[model samples]
Structures are given as C-alpha cells and as structure tokens.
Target: MNIDFEINIYHEDYHNAGSASSEIKKYLTQLGLNPKFIRKIVISSYEAEMNIVIHSLGGKLKLDIIGNHIILTSIDKGPGIRDIKMALTEGFSTASKKVREMGFGAGMGLPNMKKNSDKFEIKSSPKGTIVRLSWVIE
Candidate 1:
C-alpha cells in the first residue's frame, strides 16, 4: 500500500513542527509497523520537519509509505544549505537566537535523522532545499 501526506512548514514553531510526524506515526501504527521502525520514522520525520521550520523560508513535507518501506521527503523554499558536510555534523547549528532561546538549537537534527533513517539524500541550492529519507520495516 502507498500512503502520502502533506505538511506545512512554519518557521520557529516548535508546537507545530512535529505535527506531521505525529500523523505519520498514527498511520504507521495503524498499519502495524514494528515499534522500532515507527520510532525511527518519527524521529527522522521530526528532525526533517524542524529543519524546514528553522532553515527554509517555508515549505512542505511529503511522506510516502509503501508496504514495508517508509519514505519522507521535505521540500523547502528557504536558502539552501551552503555546507552540507558541516550541517550534518553533530552539535552544529545555524538556528537564530530566537530559535535557540526555545531550546531547539542543539544542532542534532540532521545527525539524528541520518542516524535513524536507512537512506538519506539532501539536495540544496540557493533557491531551496529538499531532503529525502527512507527506512525498511524489517
């Protein structure tokens, strides 16, 4: 089965950042995915969502669930990441002071997403950024 969802990206909104992931989790649970797989998907989704909110000007997330595989695609209209290598490093952050004040600028988002997802791809340009993440159920 294939499932898809669209999520809005709102800047600096922690309260709404994880909403997409939450919906994804609910659907995965309903589909009887393993707890570990579900957890990983949730974490990765949350991280990607936050990246959209913090880094991008604005964008949307598309989650695709196909049988035993889960794929998450995050598309944003903000400035693309100039240094993908540095951005993936642990403890590296570019979040603004206002975002940091919310206690979300520890810089673990990309690292955590990479750690949890089986496959990760990032495409970025001066115009925007697109992140794709996937994992197997088994």
Candidate 2:
C-alpha cells in the first residue's frame, strides 16, 4: 500500500507544528502499521515539522508511505543551514531567543530524527533547505 500527504508551514506557529505528524500518524494507524513503527514515524515527523516551524519562514512537509517503509520530506524556504555537520549535532541551535523561551531550542531535533529514522539526508543552501527521512518497518 502507498500513501502520500502534504502540509503547509506558517511562521511562528507552534500550535500547528505537529498537525502534519498527527495526520500521518492517523493514516498509518488506519493502514495497520505496527505500534513501534507508528511511534517512530510520529517522532521523526514531529521533529521534521518542528524544524520547519522554528527555522524557516515557511515551507512544506511531504510524506510517502510505501509498504513497510515511511519516507518524510521537509522543505523550507529559510536562511538554510550554514553547517550541516553542526546542525546534526546533538546540542547546536540557531533558533532565536523567543524560540528558546518556548523550551524548544535544545537542538536535539535533527539528531533525534536521525536516530529514529533508518535513513536521513539533509541538503541546504542559500536558497533553502531540504530534509529527507526514511524508516523501515519490520
């Protein structure tokens, strides 16, 4: 079975940050994905969504579910990552003070997403940023 979804991003919208992930989780549950896989997908998707909301002015999230695998793509039109290596680290952040005050700027988003996904790739430039995360269910 295959499933696909897309979500819009808005600036400073923490309230709607996890909406896309929630929709994806609902779809995965209806499709009968195992509990463990569903949790992994939800966590990774939420991380990706939060990154877009915190780092970018606006963007979109795309999800593709293929059989036992889930693929998530997050694209943003922001300042882009200056250092992919540093961004992937566990405790590096470029978030603003306001974002930090919200208790969400610990910089664990990318690292946690990578940890939960079977495959992760990040591409960024002055133009924008694109992140792809994939997980395989047993």
Candidate number with greatest TM-score: 2
For model 1, residues 1-138, the per-residue Cα lDDT tens digits are 777888887876767878888888888899887888789989988888888888788898898878877789999996899899999999999988888998888989989989999999998998998889988776
lDDT of each: 0.86, 0.87
Error of 2 at 48 (Å): 0.8
Query: Per-residue CA lDDT of candidate 2, range 1-138, in tens?
Result: 687879998767988878988988888798786889789878988888898888887899998878877789999997799999999999999888988999988989999899988999999997889999988866
Error of 1 at 107 (Å): 1.1
Q: Count the backbone clashes (under 3 Å) in each candidate.
A: 1, 0
Off by more than 4 A, model 2:
none
| Candidate 1 lDDT score at position 88 | 95
